[model samples]
Target: MIKALAAKAHTYVVLADGSVPNPTRNAPGALTGKVNTVLGILAWAGTAAGVAGVLITGAMMAISMRRGEGSEHMGRLGMVLGGCVLVATAGPVVTFVFG
Candidate 1:
């Protein structure tokens, strides 16, 4: 009886195909599409805001320097640096949020 059971189990195992199935074989549905679209919009907005911030900060720094306001110039330079950081980090931020 024990041998017979073992043989039957072996036959069952041998009958199964060895191919592994993919977890994400099916394409994402509507919800995924909406999420991706929202994420894309957020990324675009962030990039635009960062660029505008950088431009405004640069102008402020230039004006401050022209007036010889050394302290204000440094502050404006810091803002410009921060804006650059924002631009550089936007993509990662979006991925972090949506991924």
Candidate 2:
């Protein structure tokens, strides 16, 4: 009990003097920003891939439909495949944003 009281008193003394343990850190370090930039580039690339997939898929759908029944299924398959590619792109985007 005495030890506990002494510890509390010591903390109070420090507080009264306006001193804190582990002062606010000002340095983010050099590497932190560089790492962020690298991740940002990767994220942009992934987003670009998603956009390309969606556009290519849409184009394939249009061309297939114009070609008639023979290509209609192929066009639809392409669209579905493109959607998958786009959805997959989200993972990298999130990693970049949150990482």
Q: Quote each prediction's TM-score.
A: 0.53, 0.46
TM-score winner = 1
| Candidate 2 backbone collisions, by pair | none
In terms of lDDT, the poorest run of 10 residues in model 1 is: 17-26
Error of 1 at 73 (Å): 4.7
- Please report, in order, the local distance difference test score of every candidate based on alpha carbons: 0.74, 0.71
lDDT digits (tens) for residues 1-99 of candidate 2:
999999999999989998856666565778878877886787677667667666776777677678774555565556667666766676677779654
Write model 1 residue lDDT over 1-99, tens digit each, in one string. Answer: 999999989767766656543445355698789977997897788778777877777787778788888655567667667876876787788679645
Which regions of candidate 2 fall more than 4 Å away from where they truly are?
1-28, 70-99
